[model samples]
Target: MKHARPLPAYMVTRYHGWKATTHAENKGWYRRLADEGQRPRAMIISCCDSRVHVTSIFGADQGEFFIHRNIANLVPPFQPDGSQHGTSAAVEYAVTALKVSHLVVLGHSSCGGVAGCYDMCSGNAPELEETGSFVGRWMDILRPGYDMLPEGDDEARTRALEKVSVTVSLNNLMTFPFVQKAVEEGTLSLHGLWNDIGEGTLEGYDPDVDAFVAI
Candidate 1:
């Protein structure tokens, strides 16, 4: 099947608008970034959801953050066994190359990935369990998180698992020897966050309280 050769007109129009406004206005900043290269302070792993606007929500400018988005913002255990791990590659570059001070895993409410995991764990989604299913395999990372939560209604379970996704990712990050060393040496800090898409609110995971506290 042939794919659309060119981008849609609306997308081109939006790009032009952005160029005239955000890009042109910050021409010098963009130029400087080009010349000096990027040295972002934080590496944010967030969902692929279009609703989660990383830069806008943080009021960040160009070159401010190193952001990576995947289905559920997950970081699998560091497996350097000649396997292609996109998330792990980003984490390695951010930590070893960029030497970023913060590594954040941002989960969000109404996460379809979390819901899928819920359905998957509950045996409601057979396709996910299939060997040919990529989403099912990916969401398996969140299985331990789901298993940790107290049983509840579907809505409650999904909501709780969304937060659990963050903590689980945080735990997974530590499995990397470099990440653990950085945290121990005080060069890096790990954070877990849950975004309420509609409410425009954020909650941070508190290890002490073992709950998500409004931030």
Candidate 2:
């Protein structure tokens, strides 16, 4: 019946280290943030992959960005069926509540979620095709992207889908009525990005050019 346990040794040690240094140095700023509440200007939808460090990549300061992470950094189309949807809830809060000026969907290279989706669409990942598979169902958001993928080897196809995931999310974001209204009123903007983890390269989707240009 117990739902919690003591912190791991490594985590405890790291917490102490941070408390002694980072927390100590930012004690005043932390207090101010707590008292005033967060007013971040942007919302970032990113992958759950550990390698994709959203704040570090942008050199962002604490409380500067509102971030939500999920499989493949996907945004599902608006569905008001009254079921629980964590990703959708985050988007709703960020756009309608937080009123973030910019919303970004950030994907990355070598994403396991994207790879799984690729294989699933290709009929290579039978396990993921099961109806009870949460991952398979979640990845259905990227199914359209898979269908649009250009012909290529597995390596190239996987990489391309990574970016396609971002585009798909960006498109889906617009499906939300609030998001569409905010964008139409010129109060919000949508962006798609793909991060090349190993190469340390960042690309932003350019609708004008229909490509991801290095940024």
TM-score of each: 0.97, 0.98
Off by over 4 Å in 2: none
Predictions: Cα RMSD each: 1.3, 0.8
Best by TM-score: 2
lDDT of 2 by residue, 1-215 (tens): 49989999999999999999999999999999999999999999999999999999999988899999999999999999999999999999998898899999999999999999999999999999999999999999999999889998999999999999999999998999999999999999999999999999999999999999999
Q: Once model 2 is optimally superposed onto the true structure by TM-score, how far is the C-alpha of residue 66 displaced, in angstroms?
A: 0.6
In model 1, which regions exceed 4 Å deviation?
1-4
Whole-structure CA lDDT of model 2: 0.95
What's the count of clashing pairs in each model shown? Answer: 0, 0
**What TM-score does candidate 2 get on C-alpha atoms?**
0.98
- The best candidate by lDDT is 2
Q: In model 2, what are the clashing residue pairs, if there are any?
A: none
Summarize candidate 1's per-residue lDDT along 44-96 as a digit string, tens digits: 99999999999999999878899999998888987889978999999999999
